[model samples]
Structure formats: structure tokens, C-alpha cells
Target chain A: MDADKHFIVGVFDDEEVLLKGIGKIRGNGVKIHDVYSPFPVHGIDDALSIKRSRLPIAAFMFGMTGTALALLMQIWMLGYDWPMIIGGKNHASLPPFIPVTFELTVLLAALGMVGTFFIASDMKPYKWPRQFDLRSTEDKHVMAIDLAINSGKTKDELRSLLRDSGASEVNEKSFE
Target chain B: MQVASSLREALITGGKTVKDVSHDISRHVENKPTKLWWAAMAISVAVMAYGFYCLCYLLWEGVGVWGLNKTVGWAWDITNFVWWVGIGHAGTLISAILLLFRQRWRMSINRAAEAMTIFAVICAATFPFAHMGRLWLGFYWVFPLPNTWGSLWANFNSPLLWDVFAISTYFTVSLVFWYMGLIPDFAVIRDRAVVQGAKIRAQVYNALSFGWQGGAKTWMRYESVALILAGLSTPLVLSVHTIVSMDFATSVIPGWHTTIFPPYFVAGAIFSGFAMVLTLLLITRKVFKLEDYITIYHIELMNIIIIITGSIVGIAYITELFIAWYSGVEYEGYAFYNRVSGPFAWSYWSMMTCNVISPQLFWVKKIRTSLVATFVLSIVVNIGMWFERFVIIVTSLHRDYIPSSWTMFSPTMYDIGEYLFTFGFFFTAFLLFAKFFPVINMAEVKSIVKVASLEKKENASH
Candidate 1:
């Protein structure tokens, strides 16, 4: 279980209303904890002010590793380990290495990116996710605002902000 | 007719809300097994059992049980391998390529296509296994692993080795792409299970979903990963079949040698792959009642690709003939001549008609748009592609360089049995997958619906 934290959760019936609610609430300087939607709402990340993911840099680094490893593995195995000339071609030919090199590059890139993603997202097999709203997956979008972030605001003030900003219902949420 | 054609054609028919999309797609997995599911499963199992018996008998009897001799070592087995592998190309084309192109229509169909790629690859894999008659040590011998034998290594020179690496890598990548895409949909189901008060269901789906919170940060990461994977797989789809083509082109076996094979094989692979997708989806769309999700637009667009690739394949076929004649090499000339007017002329003509001539009918708007016509043509195209492989493998090999060894080759019951084994394995695996997982890409589908919904909202506000 994660460290318990108090959250002001707003449930929304529609994505448009949710988007507008996010804008109004953010304009009022209330920090958002997280928004959960059944689907990826277009422009929601911009609305949430989330930084763009750095996954491509990770993918490129992994791909280079794979390329370097593939070349070394092939050269070492064929040229140094036990050189044998088949079909009158050189043992360490560049032409033949391209296919294997390409494959290893792709394999490492895909695996590394997924591994990085799982780690970055803090997805552990043992940890259960805090479910803010059961309807979040089915149809509704749920936005949770952390109360601890805005110490100046009381619970009532945040609740009213949620309601005025198009929250169908405002409820207190806690996560372990 | 023109007015009817001009009628607003949305990729998604039947106005469905975001919730409806989730409910409709997830119901297959969340609900009880329908009788159709049971019937299909029972039939698939029965066929699979028979196929399993065939494999066991094949192992017991050895490779000799199939029709193989000095002349034709690769006939039905490799043909089936190439065919199944080719059939799998459409899945990647639909998922990765379409995604890269920003085709919104791809959203609804990609899940099933990616699943098809996995299943088809699985089916393709059996041929290699069957080719390894000594199944126990076959893996150790063929697979490149450090052995106790001094200075032992697989031949990097061999295209076969390249194939081993390519197919395995393709399988791994496609699998990651497919499973990663499933995470969000699985989360959707998990949340639904929670609401239904099904504790066991919720717990199971949550574990499967990897604690997906559907946060904006997660979605951003999710979208980026999908794009990168699509980029990775696009080259993969092309490379795999190119390497497969090299298996023939690298050889000097008369008809086997050609510069045209890589692009030719790639086109043929996509051509056959789309046909297989259409064949399966036509039945699946009806059975699952997913007409709205898998609309006529999707079907027609796929058919247009078929026509284009089919034309490319047709040109390749002609080029092969022209080159064989122009080279003036006796073996190559005889190879092409023998195909058109040889012992296996029936198979050659079948290939031409099915692969080339029939698909041209798609130029007619009505023919391509008709579901029944599309279904029938899809099957026809598959048969044509199967014959195309047979023509390449068997026809080429049946007549050897040495006149004395030249002989006819045909599939024994074991060969048919081996093929049936893959069909059973593929369908059984797919049917179970359909029942257990979100058959539609719920998240992607919802994005499209979400956009449409937003547009509707703006109109109302104005």
C-alpha cells in the first residue's frame, strides 16, 4: 500500500465537462493529483500539464546497445572464435550481419522501452492500484486533487471549486 | 446509386457512446461463453486433437512419412510455412503501418489483426518444427547456442539462420506490442468488474492489467510507446518477409534465384495477409455482431490495398517470366516454360487467376463494397496465394538439375495432417483469445468516438 493521502475527487459524466472542469480548477491554482479516464481523452495531458514522456531517448539508447552488441557478437563468434568460409564469402562479412543486427536492435528497443515504462509508471506486481471511481473504466472520467498540495485551502473550499467546475459529485478519497 | 454512395459514410456506424464502446467490447470477455463460442471451441478442439495425433504419428514415423525424396526436400511443409507467415503480414500492416499513417479507421480493427499476426506466426512456426524430424535434439542443433563442441556456431551465411533470428524477433516484438495495447482495455474491464461487485473478476483483471490507473501521464507514455512500436514493427514486417524471400533468392536452384523476390515477397505477403484478415474478420464481425466497430469502410479500404498489392504481385509474376526468358539460361527458361505448360500447369493457372485476375474485380465499387462478394473473394485470394507458394516450391524442386533425379512430388496424408494441425492450433488459440481478451481495441475505438462526441458537443454549444 502507498502512503495514505487525502484527495478531493471529482467525478464527471462527460469528457468535455471534465476538460472544462480541469481548466477551471487549474485556473484557480488547485494542483491536480491524477485524472482517470476509460479512454485517452485528446489534449487531456496538455490540460493536466504533464511533461512529455522521454521514452524515445530510452528507445534510441537501447537500440544502439543492441546494434553494438549484435556486431560484437557476430564478429567475435565468426571471425575470432572459429572462422569458416562458407560459399566463398568471408567469415565476418558486413552484408550478412545486417539482418541479425536489425533483429537484435528491434528486440532490445521493444523490450527496453516496455521495461522502462513499467518501472517509470511504478507498476509493481504486488502493489494494488487505488481505485478512485469504479465508473472510471466503464464510462465516467474521475479527477482527483491532492489536498496536501494546497495547504491554504480548506476541504470545503476545494469541494465547492470541484462542484462549480462541473463535477457531478465531489467526494473525499484516500489511498493507501 | 450515386446519391446512395454519397450518403455520409462514417467508419463507425450505429452511434455509440464511450460507455457503450466499453460495455460492447468487454462483454465478450466479461460475459458467459455464448453457445456459438462453445460450438466453435468444440470443433476446433476436435480438429486439433486429430492434428495432434498427426504430429505424434509424424514424430514416431519420422520425416520419411511425408513425401520427400532426393529432388523435393521442401514441398508442402515449406509452402505451408511461407503461406502462414505471409498471411500474418496484414496484422502488422493494419496495426503498425496504419497507426503510423494516422489512419483512424485502423483503431477499431488493430487488436484482432495483431492477434492474427501472433497466431499466424505460431502456425508458421510449426513447419520449422515439423522440418526438424528429430524434434528432441532438433532445437539444440538448429538454434544458435554455445555448444560443448569445439568452435561450433550457426552459419551466419545461411538465410535459414537469418530466418530463425528474424521470425523469433518478429514474434517477440509483435507480442509486446499486442500485450501493451491490451493493458488499457484490461483496465477498463477491471474497473467494470469492480463496479459489478465481482471481487474475483476484479482481482484477476487488475493483475492482468498491471495496476493501470488511466492517468494522463500513463496515457501519454502509452501513446508514445505505441508510435515507437509501430515504427519498429513497420521495418520488421518488411524485413521478415524479405529475409524469407532470401531463403529462395540466395539459392542457385534455377527458378529459386531472382532479384525480384524481396519486394515481390513483401507485396505477396501483405496481399495474402490482408486476404486472410478479411476472411477471418468477415466471419468474426458477423459472429460477434461488431458491424459498427468493423464497418464496411474498413472492409472496403482493406480491399483497395488488396488490389494494389495484387497488382504488384501480378507485375512480379510477369517479371519473373520475362527475366527467365530474357536470361536465355536453359535451366531458368525451362523453369518458366515448364510452369506455364508443365506437369503442374493447373496450379500455375490457379495462381494466376486467383492472385491476379480475380482481385482486379475490386476496381468495381460494388464488388469491393459487397460483403458477400468480399468474403468469397477473400477466400479465393487465399487459395490463390497458397497455390502461388506451391508453384514456387514444388514446381521448382520437382525437376532437378540432373534429369535422372527429376520426379513428381505430392503431399502424403501426414503432410495434410501437419497442415491441419496448424489450422487447429491457430483457430483454437484465436477463439480462446477472442473470448478472454478485448477483441476490439477499446481505447483506440473510444478515442474516435470521443472525438465524434466532442464535435457533437461543440455543435450543440454553438
Candidate 2:
């Protein structure tokens, strides 16, 4: 295995332990590469100091785009291009246009946010994700420490630190 | 950590650990289809085949094959359209509305409910498309696309045009929401498949999950995206049925032209939607042996929603009558009077009894909690809601100001067949989903188990 690709992985069976272990492991001068679990462990982000996601901001921008596009489309189509009188109403009535506008706004916001999430998280079809431990997707919470990042400590030192911080098992992983 | 009040009832019972949740939910997906599942699939497929035949024959014969006359142009088609759309509401309501309220009980049931919504919307869209009689050629005409026909855009001022946008957007957004939730659960299945040496299952689920790794950063983004989607869907679901109601409310017809249609229709949609949810969940829990996850307490809470919405619908019905009488408008008065005592008074009374009266029985703790009663009453509520739509469309149109064009509307065999086709499609899709996909939101449900289970907390502390 490449020296740079070496990692010390800790497996946790309990969410509470994993959460507290995040802080304890980091406190011992070990930088966590990532923590993987079967479900979203509440407050794990704060524990890992992961920044809050900007997905909602992206959703809002997309929603605004939808609103503008919808209004422009309706106004351009009914007002300028081929206006027809249906209910003795105006050519481009705003009230009648609201439903479609609302629908499009929601549509764009949802789809856009989902797309952004996939991109931001690097999630996509056929993308083989790096599973430090497959059990991380099951009952175990797996925390990975990059050996290169924590070169100050030996492998044995990191492994014992993980075990002391509530890890049931500590394993070494490396990738080319 | 979320700590449920000591006094609160446990959301997940049967003393489930994280491993048990994964095992219990994924086993259904990982294992071969049970004999009951095969039997259900066979029946649904047979119905779908028959319905497909009817749809083909209808397409070949044209709109004249149905009993649509000049007066009652909108009968079963519109009724079924509204009914299916209304049924679609509960999924988003549970996933979105209840989510905003932070109701943890929704975790177990939202997956199936949202799937039902997708299927129901597909069923709803069938009516308007099939009613067009030449859907193959004219389907694209609904969209405001730049066409060859002189750039003659679809009428923006028309509710019919607005419906096209509304339903399509609603379906797309709901599908995205449902699929997003399924990703993490799919990852769970995929990981289990790897351990069990099920290569095909692992590959399929991995692709379906879009290679979700469940990393802390990814999960943080996933949660934010989910929350925003839920916020978007809440208003989107309400707007969908409100626009559907506008199809009638915006019209000048005596019975149809009521300002109360929007709120009333939305309430009725939720009422019928909850009934449908109850109908599906009760069977799902029993068939999948998920009794512990979807406990009787969940049923009781759902029943309470049914009571609230049902009473609202009942009040709307009465208020419509009172307003007709109070307005002193002969046409409006005659419309309500005819609805009560007219030739089709049977449907009106059926609507009242089934939707208004039957759900009220849920007030009795015994009836509401009993699986048999909820199952039976849920079907009753759906049938009544169907009649409610039928009575509104057919009765209102059957008697116009001019007696010459006024005529009774009756459904041909094709009408009934088209409806069966939708049922077949819905059940077939749902069964396939239940068999293959995780029927419960395993990820979400797992998140709550530690907090929701008092025993687990106690055990942990010990």
C-alpha cells in the first residue's frame, strides 16, 4: 500500500459513543478524514466541525429563476406573441398565471436542490464510493483517520487512542 | 441527542436495536418474494392486462364509445381525475407537512405513502389524457411549447391549462423527494447485499443509491436538501388540490361556482388521502409483519386526522347548502335542492353517509383502533369521496337553466374499465415497489429508535 494512502479506521457500534469519540479523537491531535454511518447521526456535523450546507440557498436561487422564467414565458407568450381573449379577461392575466408560476417555482427548487446535493456530495449513478468499512452502511459507525495527516503519531498509538475512545475495533486501510 | 419525554409513548416498539431495524426492514427486500406477494402480483397483473385492453379499445373507438353526452361532458373522467389527485395528497402531507411539524411517527409510513402519491398522480393524469380521445397526437399540446400551429400558445387564463402545469410539476417534485429518501435506505440494502454475497443485488442497489457513502459531510448536505424539499412540497401539495378545485370554482355553473371550493376541496383531498393511507398502511403492516414499527398508536393518530378533515368536509357540505338558501338565488337553491332530492339523490346521500357519517365512527376509540374497522372505513371513505366528485360533476351538469340541453350522464363500460386500468397500474407498481424497495424508511426510522425507545435509553445508561 502507498504510504500516503494509509488510514487508521475505527468502528463504533453506538451513535453516542461515535459522537463523543469524534471530539475525543480530534482532541488527541488526530484529524478525522471522514465518518460514515448507516444513518445521519444527529449533531455529528457539529462534532466533526462540518460546515452547514448551502443547499437551501441554492434552492432559493433556483426557485427565483423558476418564478422569473414562468412569468416571462407567460407574458411573452400571451401578451406579445399570440394573445387571445378567453374569459373577456386581459391578454396576460396575473391571477390566472399564479398557479403555473407557483408550480414551476417548486419544481425548479426541488429538482435544482437535489441536483446540487448530488453534485456537492459527489453522488451519482455508477460512482463507486470508497467504503472504509461496509458495516458503516449497516449498524456500525466508521471513523477514518488519515495516517499522512497525523504523522506525528505511530499507527499503534492511533489504534490504541481509537480503542480508548470507545471504538470496538480499530483496523488499518489503504488505497492506491 | 433527541430525548423523548418520559411520559410520551414509544414510537418504535418491540425493543429494536439499530441492527434489528436494518435486519427487519432489509430482509423483506433481500429475500425472495413470499407466496402472498406472488399471488398479489399475479392478481394485479391480471387486472392491469384487462384494463390495458379496455384502454386500447377506448383509444380505437374514440370518445363516443363512452356515455358522455353534450350536457354532462365531465362525469367519471373528471370525477376519477379529482379522486386520484385527492388521494395523492396524503403522501406529501405526511412526508412534508408532518415533517415540518417534527412528527416522528411519520418516519415509518412516509415511504409507502409517498409511493402511493406518485402512483395516484399517475392514475389521476390518465383521466384527462384518455379523455382527450387522441392522446398519442394531442398530449404534447397541453404544454405551452412553440408549436407549428401559428404559435397559438395554450390559454394561460384557463384552469385546464393551469392543471397541466400543476399536475406535472407536482408529480416530478414528489418523485424526486421520494427517490431522494430512498437513496440512503438503498445504501443499507447494498451494504447488506455485499456481506451476504448477493452481487447482483449489491450492484443494483448501489446504482440506485447513487453510491451514497453516508459520510458526515454528505449527510449534512442530504439533511439540508431534505428539509428544503419538505418546505417546498408543503405549499406545492396544497396548491395542487386548490388548483384542481379551481377547475370547478372558477366556472360559472350554478353548483360549481362556489368560493368555498378551494379550502373544501383541499380538506376533502386530505380526508380521502388519509383514508387511503390508512387503507394501505394497515394491509402493509400486516402483510410485511411490521406491526411493531407501525403500531396501533400510529393508526390512532391517523384516525384523528381523518376525523378533523372529515368534519371539515361535512361542514363545507352544509355551508354550501346554507349559502345557497341564504343567497336567495333560485339557480343555486335549485342546485342544492336537486342534489338532495333529484334523480341522482342516491349518490348525494351516499356521499354524506360514507364521507360525513362513517368517519365520525372513528371518534369511538374501539372503531378507530380496530384494524378491521379502519380498513373497512377507509375503503368506505374512498368510495364516498368518489361519489362526492361524481355528485358534484354529474348532478350539477344534469340540470341546466335550459331544459333542452340538460341530460343525464351515465358511464359506459369503457369508463369503468379505464378506472380499473388505473387501479391495476397503481397496485402493480406499489407491489413491485414493496417487494424490491425498502417498504419503510429504514434510515429515518433508525435515527429515531435510540431516542424513541425508552428502554434503549435505559439500557444505554446501564
Q: Which candidate leads the pack in TM-score?
A: 2
- Give the clashing residue pairs of candidate 1, or none: A2-A176
lDDT of 1 by residue, B179-276 (tens): 99999888888888877888888888888889988887888898899999999999999999999999999999888899999999999999999998
TM-score of chain B of 2: 0.98
Each prediction's total of clashing residue pairs, residues at least 3 apart in sequence or on different chains, is: 1, 0
Question: DockQ of each model against the real complex?
Answer: 0.61, 0.88
Off by over 4 Å in 1: A1-4, B1-8, B453-462
Best by lDDT: 2
Interface RMSD of each: 3.4, 0.8
lDDT (Cα) of model 2: 0.92
TM-score of 2: 0.98
Model 2: residues with Cα > 4 Å off, grouped in runs: A1-4, B456-462
RMSD of each: 3.1, 1.5
